[model samples]
Every structure is written in structure tokens, then in C-alpha cells.
Target chain A: MNATASLDARGKSCPLPIVLTAKALRELNAGEVLLVRANDLAFVSDIEAWCKKTGHELLGIVSESGFLEARIRKAA
Target chain B: MGVTEEALLDDPSAEPQPSGVFETELRRLSQRVAELEARQHSLARSAAQEDKITLLVFSNSLDRLLAAFTMATGAAAMGTRVSLFFTFWGTAALRRENVQTKKSLFARLFGWMLPKGSRNLPLSQLNMGGMGPLMMRRLMKQKGVASLEEMLALSRELGVNISVCSMSMDLLGFQPQEMIEYPNLTYCGVATFLERAATGKMTLFV
Candidate 1:
């Protein structure tokens, strides 16, 4: 799926990746998609809970060779 | 409609007469479901009240300050509203100057004894002649972890409310200009902090 924006947070730690993702998500219009790359192990569950708490839609997460990619859709 | 329990009880020619047991079981299950729903409703209401984290910064030691900022940033990142209330020695952590200040006799003695601001904060233990904090800072950088300064800055950027205890400021004789310039920083008393803490989901004293 096409994403409205993409962010690379592979090297960043726990809250940093989630914090930056939130910052980027806020700039997008409702229903837009944000693709995030993170290597922090906690990022997987953290992003999931973050979306659930923030009312955003987590489309999917793909674990790559060294990192994971998450696609989230902004809520309308 | 299905055969009513009243009908089954009232009828003298009912088969087996097992309606009493079935009705009791149904009543118990309905009561359980209602109890569960009520609990869910209360949880939903509490969640709707919004999440709040109150961090009481009572110590100005480097490690404690790091812990406090980490807590604030972590909470803020999770979309929880955080308030960092600096009081007592914690006020020294927010000072802008890293040097000893020449103020009143007591203020000057405090300045000479306590570390000034985030940068000058010493480790609470294993200081080893000031090398402990220095080594810790270096180690944090080597590990690619954010420094205390960076964490504090991130806390602010993440919308963590930073408040200085006005009573502590007065008692410590700190001038307004000596404190760090945080955006929309509040100088408040303990009563205000207590009110916020009472409503907060988590209240921590560090």
C-alpha cells in the first residue's frame, strides 16, 4: 500500500521511535498512511499499543532482515 | 415466545420439573454478565478521564534527575499527560548557570555545596571525586543513549509540563533569571501540585 509519509527510526531507542512516529503522524491529514522503520524490539508492541491508545489504525507490521516496518493509518 | 419459567412453575403437568434449576442457572449467568458490564463501564469511564502522570522531582542528583526525565519522556511518548514538579534540591537541577552563585550567605553556601543545574549535578553515590557522573555521561554517549540534557529537552518537546515549586525557589533564594527557560513553565505552590497529583493516574516522588 502507498504511504503518505515514511520515517526511518531504525537506530533510535524505545520512546524515541514512538515519539517521532507520533510527531510525524500529527502532521498528516486524517486517513493518511505513515510508514515507520524501527529496530528497537519494543517498537513492535509499543507501536501497537500506541495506535490502540491514540485511536489510530495499525495496518500491518513486516519484520525485515534487521528491522521492522509498520504502516499506520490516521483515524478519521 | 418460549415457555416462561412462571408457566413451567405454575403448571402441574410439566415434565421433569427441571425449570427451577435452569432458571437459577440463567439468573446467575445474567447477574455475572451484568457485573462484568458494570466493571467494563467503570474502566471505560476511568480511561475517558484521561491518563495523567505526576513526577515529583525532589532530588537534584544526576541519576535521579535522569530517572525523572526518562519517566516524563516515556509517559509523554505514550500520549499520557505528564507534570514534572521540581522542589527542594530538585530546583538546582533546573538552574541555568553551572557555576557557584554569590547570593545570600545561605544561598552562597548552598551553591558551593550542591551542584548547579543539570550539567553540574553529581551522582548520588560512587561519585569517586566527581568522576562517576563524568564516566556515566561518557558511557551513556558510547551506548548511544540520550544524555540527561537531551532527555530533559525531549521531555519538553513531548509536551511534558515542567513546573518549579515556588516555595522551594523562595526558600532557596533563587532568582527567576537563574532558572532554565522552559516554554510555558509554571511556578506553583504545593497545593497546586497536590490537586494535580490527586487527579493523576500515577503520582511518583523521585
Candidate 2:
């Protein structure tokens, strides 16, 4: 499938990483995936909560070295 | 034992014998118990402090672009639980649609004629029209200050949650689909944010 955009939220905090990810997704159409990077420890739960709160789907959350790379699908 | 009364009265400097040593030992034990109780009390207080979580709330205003970005990154840097909400024109400033922001007459005219989103927000703290903005921009440039876009980008990379007021969007006749695809945006009304902010956390109206 043709991929959309990618976002890196590494080292970002409560709302910033999410904000940047949202901005990237805003530039894409539905069903597009955004690659995100974040090192904020809170992102583990924060992204989970965002998905629940906004209905966005998290495709995967993987650790690269110590940082996290998250894949998100724009559902709504 | 009968001689002890007379002896005690006659020689007060006599070595303390084991006869009353048990009493002395009991007193010492009681003193130690008191000390332990005091330590326990202090330890309980310290533990309570350790259990408490810090929370900070930031309000993003239309003109407070840099401030909003700074607050997001700063609070996160401090490891405080942070939440920032964008409302009204604040949401307008974050138009993921990259729509030409409707600011000046020229911008509005161009916005209507072209596909550009709302005009990028002009910094309220600094505007080139006046000396304040001019000085601020000069200082920023000299100090290597990041642009508003750069700050927001860093803030998002740090995992800040970005919210757009749903009511504001409706009033402006804007749709989410019209904007670019960003994973960080949350659509909520003013009431929604307030309900969450009522938890004794920081609530800023910036």
C-alpha cells in the first residue's frame, strides 16, 4: 500500500508529540499511516489514551534502541 | 533492703546498683520508643510527598504561539503531567489544513481565491508593525530563537497532546477533513477540556 506521512515524537512530552502527529495526519487522507518517534515515557499511556479518546488506531509501537517508533492510522 | 533506706540517705553518691537498674533501663527503652515514633511520623510525611503527582495545565491562545510551545516543552521537561488545550482562535492558529490564516485583508483575499489555509499566526508578543515586535524578533534572531513552527514541531516530538476545539471549528465552518492528516489532534469542546482540567491540575487561560 502507498504510505502517507511519518511523524517523530521522540523526546517530546504530554501534548507535543501528539500535536505534531496530529499535524502530520492533518496533511494526509483517511487510511494513511504516519510514522512517529517519541522518547517520552508517558507516551506509552498517552498514545493509548489518545487512540481511545480520538478513535485513531495504533498499528504498532516498537523500541529502536531506547526510543520508540509508533505507527498510527488515521481513522477519524 | 532495710539497710538500703538509711544507706541511700547517707551516701547519695553511691554507684547506681542493679537494684534499680531495671527502672533505668525501662526509662531508656521508653525514650528510644519515643524517638522511633518521632522518626516514624517524619517518615510518613516524607512518603506522602513522594506519592503526590505534579500536574500542569496550559491554555493555548491565538496570539500566544511561542508561549504555548514553550509551556508544553518546559512542563514536559520538568516531568510534570501536562495538558494543553486550544480553543477559539488558538485552534485557528493550529489549522493543520495549512489554510491561509485570515489575518490581513490581503491574506483574506488570497485565502478566498487560493487553496491556502488560514494565515500563519503573527506573534502577539512581537509584531514587525511596532517596535515591540521588531525588538522581539531581533532579539530572537540574535539568540537563535526557533520560529513558532519549529517550537510546535519540537513540542510534538516531545509527545504533547494537541487539541482543537470542535465548537470553534463548527462556528468557523471548518472540517477536519479539510486539514492535513496529523495524528496528534483531538477534537473537543470547551466543556470537555474544563471537565478534565478540574482535577486540581494547572489550568491556564493563556
Candidate 3:
């Protein structure tokens, strides 16, 4: 999937990844997709719930070799 | 024997025809269920409507302060409004290092005995004469975890409200000028904290 912006939150622990993702999303326009990469396993469920609560659209999530990548579209 | 009564007695599995009173009772039960369901829905809605967290920081230990700040920043990151009310010993965490203000003899002595700032706070357990905090800070740095100071800075950047208990400050002789500069920092009494906490979805004392 194509993303308008990307964030590398690898090696960051819980809350930091989610925190940085929220910060990064603020810079994107509505409907713009953000690709977030993180190693924290909690980020998967955390981002899913965060998106649901914040009204963002989670396009997809993929687990790479050691990191997980999530695509999220900003809410309009 | 009446046909309906005979059928009910002979075939216990038979469904009884609803009489006027039975029908009325069934309707009443169905209505009650609907009302309960509606009430549940409204309760959940109200729970979700509250998105603020209020934390009472009462401990000045390094470990406890770390937990408090971590929770504050974590909640703030998830779009929740967070307020930290520092009281008593916790207010010492906000003191600026090497910044001294004139105070009464007892207050000056109290300040001298307490940790100067976030960096100087000792560990609550396994302090080992102040070596524990040093070891913990080094471990956090090596593991890419944020230290207490970094978390404090991040909490400020994240717009977490920090309220210093004025009564605690006055007792400890800590002046507002001696505290670290932070955005949204306020000096207030317990009433202010209680008022904000009333509307908060979560309140913690640490």
C-alpha cells in the first residue's frame, strides 16, 4: 500500500510508538496514509484500538522479519 | 374436564395458551428488558465520553515518579487529557537543580534534606545509598527507554497539565520561581485537583 508519510518507531517501547504515531498523524492531511514501523508487539493491538477510538482508518498491518508495519489513513 | 386443563395435565410438555394475565406479565417483562438494554447503552456512552485522567503524585521516589510520568504520557499520547497534581514530597520532583530560594530555618533544612529535582530522586526500594537510581537510569538509557527527566520533558511537550499543591509548596518553602519552567503548570489547592478529578475517567494516587 502507498503511504503519504512513513515513521520508523523501531526499538521504541510501548506508548512511545503510539505517541509518535499520533504525533506523525497530526502532520498528514485528511485521507493521507501513514506507514508506521515498530518493533513493539503491543503496537499492533494498540494502534488498532487507537485508530478505532480516534476515527482513523487502518488500511492493513503486516509483520516483517523483526518489525511490524501498519498503514493508517487520517480521518476526515 | 376442560380441554385446556386436561391437555395441560396429561401432556406436561404442551405449551399453555396465554391468558390475559399471562400476556400482560410477558409484555411487562419484555418492556423491562428493553429498558435495561437502553440503560446499558447509555452507560457505555457516558463512559466513553470521559477521556480525561487525573493523577495524584504523592511519592517522590524515582521509581514511583517514573511510573506516574509514564502513565501520564501514555494516556496523553492516546488523545486523553491528563492532569498531574503534585503534592507533599512529590512536589520536590519539580524543584530546579541548584536553584535556591531564601526560606525559614526549618524550611531551608527541609529543602536541603530532600532531593533537589527529578534527577536526584532516590529509588523507593533497593536504593543502596543512592546507587540504585544511577543504575536504573543507566539501564534505561542503554535499553532505549526514556528516563524520568525525558518523560517529564515529553509530558510537558504532550501538553499534560501539571498542578503543584500550593499548601505543600508553602510547607516545604518551595517558591514558584524555583520550579522548573513548564507549560500549563499551575499552583493550586486540593480543591482544584478534586474538581478536575471529578470529571476524569481515571484517577490514580502514586
Tell the DockQ for candidate 1.
0.36
Top-scoring candidate (DockQ): 3
Residue A45 displacement in candidate 1 (angstroms): 2.4
What is the per-residue lDDT of model 3 for residues B70-148, given as tens digits with 9 covering 90 to 100? 8898888778999999999999999999976778998899799999999899999999999999999898877767788
Better of 1 and 2 by DockQ: 1
In candidate 3 chain B, what residue range of length 10 has the lowest lDDT sum?
B12-21
TM-score for each candidate, following the candidate numbering: 0.78, 0.43, 0.82
Worst 10 residues of 1 chain B by lDDT: B1-10
State the DockQ of every prediction: 0.36, 0.03, 0.52
Tens digits of per-residue lDDT for model 3, A1-76:
5899999999887668877888899999999999999998688889988888788999999999999999999989
Model 2 misplaced stretches (Cα beyond 4 Å): A1-76, B1-63, B96-119, B125-138
Rank order (by lDDT, best first): 3, 1, 2
lDDT string for model 2 (B100-194, tens) is 44355653543343322223344455445445544655566555455566665655665666667777666555567655444566787767676
Name the regions of candidate 1 deviating beyond 4 angstroms: B1-48, B98-102
Interface RMSD, all candidates in order, equals 1.9, 8.7, 1.4
Candidate 1 per-residue C-alpha lDDT over B88-189 given as tens digits, one digit per residue, 9 for 90 to 100: 999988888753456999877776676678888889998888899999999887665678888877877888999999988888888677888898898999
